[model samples]
Target chain A: MKPKYTSLQLFALTALRVSIGWHFFYEGFTKLLNPNWSSAGYLNDSQGWFAGLFHAIAGNQSLLAAADFLNVWGLIAVGVGLLIGIFSRYAALGGMLLLAFYYLSHPPLMNASYSLPSEGSYLWINKNIIELFALWLVFLFNTSSIIGIDRLLKRK
Target chain B: MSNDAENSKLLGRRNLLKALATVPLLGTLTYAGLKKHSNTAANNVEVLNALGFPKNTGLSIKPGAVGTIIHNNNPHIRLGFIGVGGRGRHLMQCAGFAPPEYVQDWMDKHAENPDDNRYQNFLEQDDLNVSVIAVCDVFDEHARLALEAASNADKKGQKDFKGITVKRYKTYQELIADKDIDAVVIATPDHWHAPIAIAAANAGKHVYVEKPMTNNVAETYELKDAVIKSGIAFQVGHQGRQTESYIRAKEVLDKGVLGKISLIEVTTNRNSPNGAWVYDLHPLATPDTIDWKQFLGNAPEIPFSPERFFRWRCWWDYASGLSGDLLTHEFDAINQVMNLGIPHSCVASGGVYFYKDGREVPDVFQAVFEYPNRDLTFLYSASLASERHRGKVFMGHDGSMDMDGVTSVYVDRASIKYKDLLDRNLVNPDEPALTFSSATGNIDAITSPTAKYFAKRGLLYTYRDGKRYDAAHLHIREWLDAIRNKQQPSCDIQQGFEEAMIAHMATISYREGVKTYWDAEKEMIVKGNSVKM
Candidate 1:
């Protein structure tokens, strides 16, 4: 069964998806082009329950390299899929996973201070948490079928 | 038929329009992204260039290679140790000979935190193509520890392994005379440094001796002459030569950023018994276990009081006290950067105001060395009772540089060189004008808060891939490289000669309460010119 949406709902949902896609795509592309780019600093700067896990990855050069490779390619892949609405479900899932890692690594809980500078003040509902929920919304209430390349994908 | 064809065409056209709708946006974004990154890169380069730094000094962590030399490329060199005390054992560990206890320690640290890769790095340390062939020490326990360290293969800290046949030489001369030994590392006391190194040099063996090269004025020239006459690769263990920041600091000084530098202040502060050279006298330390005669060397005969043997730095007969032990550190580091050879004159005064536990050397000391040629005064101050941080600072007419922990440059509010930058508001006097950071390996003007945060975490240190190299290891590697390549090591005989003379001058000024002069033509310390003690 196909989902139904008003013109306004469709525009809002697709715009949110495309905006997040642009953010992730550019983030990945920038890192990809940078020869000195590594996730070591951000990973080493992790400060939550999963800080140790991230630190472990950062400490090991080969593990850090793998993480860096995955991040650069994953962001680009998720961005492209969400932008064009091709494989939108998988893209949304990948975005959620990345966001979950980010959120876990630097959860904005009480008494937890991050070394790396973040955009705005965050208690619990930070940008990553907000984006995680938004990506979930994009997963469940996908407007890509009506307003994107998913429209063509529906026939198959 | 016409209605069906029109409907199908409309459906196909709508599908094409939806599918290709965002592809043009993607192309536009790609173009925009390229422009943005290119512009940012260009701007960063310009800003960095204006600050007089290379562009690649951004978060650049150099790998923990042997000092700066690749060791495996060179052939194997046999090593012999003359002193296996704390410093010597550490030097051996740096040369990839980790004792069982040290290996266990590093492993335990790693187990506690995966980030601590000391054990792993020790194990994975590049094979420096060197073998510890013989060990020598006056104390039995230290000798045994050295033997254990030398025999431990692969630096894995594993027990019950078939190890090398490390011969334990009771005296350093025997160790130096070993034909199998290609070179000797003289980690002995200040008194033994000259004798052992002189013997080794005469034997055509390369030498790496510990700091303040020798104890007295006589041996200072003697060691230099021997090293020159031997023509062997000699290195003084001022491991500060391998320090990354010091290297960068030298580069910055060479650039003349600190215009007309006048005063250089360096210091040492500690608030502990051990810090005051009251090192623990081991339980097993006894006349039977220790060769008191060998330990005393040529000092006036005294009963074997374990105090003197264990805490040798307290006596003027053995160690040169704070002047030789600590002052040489600051002097050599400054000398490495400033090229201020031997000072023109030195004035010093201090007393054992703190730990007055029958120690002959002063607990609080200050030495001011005047370099008339360079037009600068180098001041070194120390206190064993106070736990204060007075870093190495260079005050200049245009700016001041603090290269104690991190290489930071601050422009003078009233300045000649930085006038244009200050007027243009490109550099703020309130903050660092430029910093060669130890944490990020950056030369950017990192904010004070950011620098402090990392420093508090103990992350702001010289990097051998973020974790600083065991500088002693690099120093040893450099010595070997010099031996193999026939090149001069960083802290060579000439540097050692100046270091010894400088330290001796300070010691003499303190001892005689006189303003000691270094007569350039006569090449000897003239101490009778000032008020006597």
Candidate 2:
């Protein structure tokens, strides 16, 4: 038996999910609106180990073009799924995985340029972890009992 | 009945949550208000956009009509000059330096020629003349160069400065005692300004002392007394006061162009330590002709280090750290435009985060000055690792004018929308247009247009006929002209003392770690440790 959420907890989950979904969906929509845009400029400017990966990706313009399209589609799909509360757990897991790949690729927190690793990198608590936990907690509780379209559809 | 009780409880909880949400918003508003309240002025002129109201507006002056145009050479008193160093030298060869007579004349002839090299070359030369002057140091090298440049004015065939001769002085004392010299241009190092100024005033000669008036506060009072007693003409070298852009800014503010100005922020950005204040040490900075004793005059006596003499600004002993070097210029403009003489109190906080070359002066500093009456606050700040902000921003109740030495006035456009009473609620409520980045294109519509318009307008500046002739040339002209006509110089001794006092007080405040109050009547610091005076 799973514990059910109070109305406040349900509202908090819904707000977080919607915010994350919109953030991604907006990013995708903007890129789609401007088809000439690419990550090539940023990749060229980038240095260190990431430089190799960026160069490799930028070299195959056609393949990277497809990847760019997929990246936008993936963001929109994940955002809609989370916002609708349909496949919410799966969406959260996929979002985390995608973000982790980016986090590893760029690793803004890890400044490899500095003499000492501890002196350089800025490692604050990642928001992805918080969202991941939120997703798990939502899965444990029965959100269908709360005030959402999910609950209405189940009742019908 | 039972349902009503539950409904009331639910309503009460909702109201409590709303109240909780209001706390941060209220806190932010109050913080901003407090900042504004701290910066009010004593006069009727509210601190409009941190820059005061434009003193005078577009009452176009018809040529030769009342207040329209004063002949540069029409002044009853002529100017005589002494030190022709960095600023002094530029003033000397103004005609030859840039905007050559040929260029200006050519521009007038070919007014439609935008693509001509003559115009671009003219602008370039005009900018070159504004290079910071280097007056004679203890050594003969800088002085020799200055004299060479001063004498070369004749070679350029400038007719206005036909008869002025360049005279070199091995020592400033020799130049001061000369009978023909009526006024002196003191452009020595930061520490030497006060003693030389006092000596000049006491010797019955008027003075045009450069910016960062004095090294400390006590000298300010001494210099003030000397000038007052001598009754000589004195002009503080805040050239910005005589510029058109700053004057125009004052006019725009006075007209309530930005509505009731509230917050003023002045910022300088440098991405490197040297850009901030790192003085490069020259290998040849020895105590021989370097005048180590003279350089450290009233500053705390320490062992003769070459760095201390050459790059005195980096050390506290030879300079007022940051305040004297940069803050003086900002304060002078602020005071001139806003008429903000003395602040009620000032609190500053910052540290030297870059350049670990054992320099004592803070590399970065931010200080807030509070004034009385309507909320008027002056924020002064600088950083070595970033370059986002500029010299100053005067924020008003309605709009803000972002300004600095480079840009005269940058008015925010969102402020313009406030004129329509019906549009009051629509300002910040508009739906933000979606973009690839967080940057909304609408904000660009507000800020960039004005920047472009102002850029095209360029500098609308005019100098007195003999402007930038050479310190000695101008000083000599003023002196001889004054002697011939029995009149006063442009900047009298008293004015020099007052300008110098601002710098002195700034140094005292930074040194004592307290807000040093200026007693204008007594011309001394009213509170804190009584320094030298």
Backbone clashes counted, model 1: 0
* Residue clash pairs of candidate 1: none
lDDT of 2 by residue, A84-149 (tens): 554555666667666654544444444443221223335533454455566565555534224333
The estimated TM-scores of all candidates read: 0.82, 0.53
Which structure among the candidates has the greatest TM-score?
Answer: 1
How does each model score on lDDT? 0.83, 0.52
User: In candidate 2, residue B336 scores what lDDT?
Assistant: 64
lDDT of 2 at B108: 58
- Stretches of candidate 2 above 4 Å error? A1-156, B1-88, B91-136, B156-167, B272-274, B277-289, B300-304, B404-502, B518-523, B528-533
**lDDT tens digits by residue: candidate 1, B1-533:** 99999999999898788766777767878899999878666654654565566577643334343255664447789999998899999889888886777787888888887778878778766668788999999899999888889988666454544554689998887887789999999888888899999999999999999997999999988888999988999999999888877777876788787789999999999999988989998999999999999988899999999999889899999988999999999999999988899888899999999897999999999999888788889999999999877788999888888886567777888887778767866566766666665545656543335454443343454676665466787788888889888877999999999999999999998998888988877788888664222
**Distance (Å) between predicted and true CA of B392, model 2?**
1.8
Candidate 2 lDDT tens digits, B1-533? 99999999997566444324323432453355445433321211222222333213312321112111222333333223344434455544442332134334556555664333344433433221211122344644445545544444333323443432456565667767777665566665677777888888898876767667777767777887887788776656655554333554565566675677766777667786566555566555566646666556677778888666555677766666667777776776766667676565466667778766777777788777666554677778877678765646777655555444223333344555344421432222131110011111111111222233323233211223312112233333443344344555443444445455555555555656776665545645655534322
The DockQ-derived docking category for candidate 2 is: incorrect
Best prediction by DockQ: 1
Q: How far in Å is the alpha carbon of B186 misplaced in model 1?
A: 1.3
